[model samples]
Target: MLGPDGIKDIAKMDPREGAALLEAHIENFDGEAAMTMWLQTKPKILYKGGARSRFAAAFHPRENKFEVEVLFSKAPTDFHPTCNQIFYFGEELELALKYAWWAENRVPAEAACVLQVALPASKMSEGVYVDDAKRWERLVWHSRRVDSHGQPLEAAPDTVVSLLNERILVGPICGMSPHVVQGLPRGGWQRLTKIRLSNNQNATQVVFMNPRTFVERCEEILWVLSSVSWRGNSSQDLLVMHGLRVQPLNVGQIAAS
Candidate 1:
């Protein structure tokens, strides 16, 4: 019965050994239920797409079995999204540090291009939005259990409607590349100059600079993003950046502590 304590023990073990244990008790294991229990344990370091030194588990519907895999890198060809839904819980700064490390090591030069295209200047742009909608439709079609004659066992009209009405949060459009001033270190700042809207052509460029290391910059970006209040339509109410610059006051003490 893989209880909460067992899940905690598995979290502490080597991924391979933990997976072996899970496979040994496969009949009694339940992936979704176990994932809920695992999350309740609140592990500080987890990798989403099976990075090394983390535990990832998933349920295979076709096989009707729970499978556990050691967290490790795969060739881009071998990656599967459903089987890689791992999560980590930690301080925001710690997560940002991991992102910075991954950005330095794993993120390729082409990633910036991909990010730029994925998040276009126009909200209803014809690139990522279109691709994502098609993907969602395909997923809905595949999820239905149908007979050989192509009739669904269950009704799917509501699911299709829900997909159509989904509100995607395409974040603010800003300069994709960070800029470094003359005297600053290699780590640069991101400027959120203007917000692009249909009728708002005369919007002024508001520059916000942070001359911190890559990790600190990543942390700041995460903080800003999470702090945004989506309740109001006004820019000031939406993204309240009142005291964002106050981080510099204690920047030197952060590393030491």
Candidate 2:
């Protein structure tokens, strides 16, 4: 109902031919309101890295699985920490969708209409590291069910017990009703999920069916995204997972650490 074809065929058409159709589609599909809100809402990005790092990423926890996002920018010598985990595969960022629209849309109009989002470098997953600090420190920000490569592994257990031995902080999933108290991270049983270390180079990404019991407030799930500059190296020759808000740790009251 939101796509172009759902209402009418306009996904691919001449700018003039689809111009009116796109407009109508936008109006009918609440595209305008959503766009306006998206434009107006100031999406807040929760970064889990200190100011010193050249790049950072975070996760967003929605329902079953989590989505991780990262960002690259310039930093100065005088930088401070702005995240929970210090040594990680990558820093985390908490982005509120509403908070982003306003910030992005307000930019001054340029001669050419353009939209762009920076993604991570692909084909860099062999050693399973993304951030320079992470690679240098051999930190495991996030990991799939494999070692450094994409090959499937069996270390990841379905239950939390498997992670306990690794010293990685284990938690519950974020979105669920009557949440499953204690279970495995297999199949659809996952929830808000937690982060833990599998080795020095990587961390495990598991989901839970119950989050409230484990985590106070869940918002984003931090993980690394695969991206490369316009023209960069080959896809991740290794494996790498960054960070995002897997289940946004509720930071209602700032606690003194």
Candidate 3:
């Protein structure tokens, strides 16, 4: 996995160079192969305890939609195939894959697997709906480390951004109550997804803004991963700079299993 030094190296380059480099890393690494290796070789260190175990997203051009499914050990699997979140995408599969890699590299290994597999059995139509207008770019996410009881463990809100901007990169292990919201939208409509990461060494809060186009979104996400100070406790943090490949199975195969 890529490390903080790798990210810092990319940050020194211009955006175009940085993006190209990031793409190279993503395309070259095989995320599925890596997972197989870990599952086979290092069985005990699979994922952060209570952290997400599997995540997968797919874009169906025919449907013009994107679906993201997250599976946590805590969530009940008795339902058989789990549900996911759905949103519309204006771009093609290539862009979807790029964003997928970026997201996969940002978190720990277990959560990162979401990038490698396709949840065919996971029904898309059954997933929760996400407003396309309220895309990931539209909101800023905020996370803070907290004890099991859920309290801010470090850094004030005013200091968080600067701490991120300046590379302070300090926060709780496995974020506490992480929430997102759009800047312009006020009151109730502004809020987005909120979940807790079970580890420490991460930012308490995060936010997002949508770009005008798909390429712009990719560039912005790459830039953030390359430059933003990440405080993940695991080595997977900021590893997007390296080659982490994913072999997403087809919908039919996933569904059959």
Candidate 4:
């Protein structure tokens, strides 16, 4: 069976051998509940770059699907990406086998897997949502409380220009006259204002814009992952600078019963 120590040697083993080891570990558990309990052990595994990898395995009973996530650490102070990679399989045994195979063959040579654990599917999803909500709340509060100068807004034109530059007043510039909007910055703000006006059907238009803030971008990535189908083999450049690899595997046969 594969233990925490065995992960370091996985790179040297044939992909099939690594797969078999994972399969053996999965077979020891009776069901999803049993597997979740076993995962509480939180095995610490090391891969390349001496970075630790954390693992999260989850089974969605309603979908009859299994998911394994490998989250990598960047720095001691940096928040780890929600997941560095995600592997989905139709069967539990298949999940274990394909995950082992991918870890052995595909994970970059310099990468490391720091944390690993199992979780219920519902809990995993809930955690993601909760984290995102907190971030969104924080973003909204920041937007409302301060202008681009990082201070409270005043009636000054400079403060308005600062807000426009930071994209705080993205929609129709309420309370401000057309002359004031036109008097602001010349390049991006001018173009954005024209675009908004051309699309506006009403005098008081409320347009929603994505500031592409860090939190917003994170939400977009998560939405894409959750909405897509993950049956075929594919890869995504999810935080490539951090050496995270997201991919799928083709399973020929079940390795465990």
Arrange candidates by lDDT, descending.
3, 4, 1, 2
Q: Cα deviation of 127 in candidate 3 (Å)?
A: 27
Give model 3's TM-score versus the native structure. Answer: 0.22
lDDT of each: 0.25, 0.23, 0.26, 0.25
**Model 2 Cα shift for residue 248 (angstroms):** 5.3
Ranking of all candidate structures by their TM-score, best first: 3, 2, 4, 1
* Residue-wise C-alpha lDDT for candidate 1, range 1-257, written one tens digit per residue: 10011112222545344334444444544445434323443322211211212221222323432222221222110111121221112122222223333433464411100000001113222211312434433322322223344443335455444432333211222212212111222222222222233454421111111112222322121111111111231111111111022233344543443
Separately for all candidates shown, the number of backbone clashes (residues 3 or more apart, or on different chains) is 0, 66, 28, 11
Off by over 4 Å in 4: 1-23, 26-50, 53-111, 114-118, 124-257
Residue 24 alpha-carbon offset, candidate 2, angstroms: 16
* Per-residue lDDT over 1-257 for candidate 4, one digit per residue giving the tens place of the 0 to 100 score: 22133222332434344334444443332344333332442211112112213232222323323332222222110011121222211112122332344454455722222222222223222121112323332222222333444442222244333333331111222223333433444222312221122334311211111112211222111110110012233322111111111222211111110
Alpha carbon lDDT of residue 16, candidate 1?
43
TM-score: model 4 vs. ground truth: 0.19
| Better by lDDT, candidate 2 or 1 | 1
* Pick by TM-score: 1 or 3, better one: 3
Return the top candidate by TM-score: 3
Candidate 4 residue 143 C-alpha distance from true site, Å: 14
lDDT of 3 at 100: 41
Candidate 3 lDDT over residue span 190-224, tens digit each: 33333322232221211111111111122112211
Task: Give the RMSD in angstroms, all C-alphas superposed, for model 4.
Answer: 19.4
Using lDDT, give the best candidate's number: 3
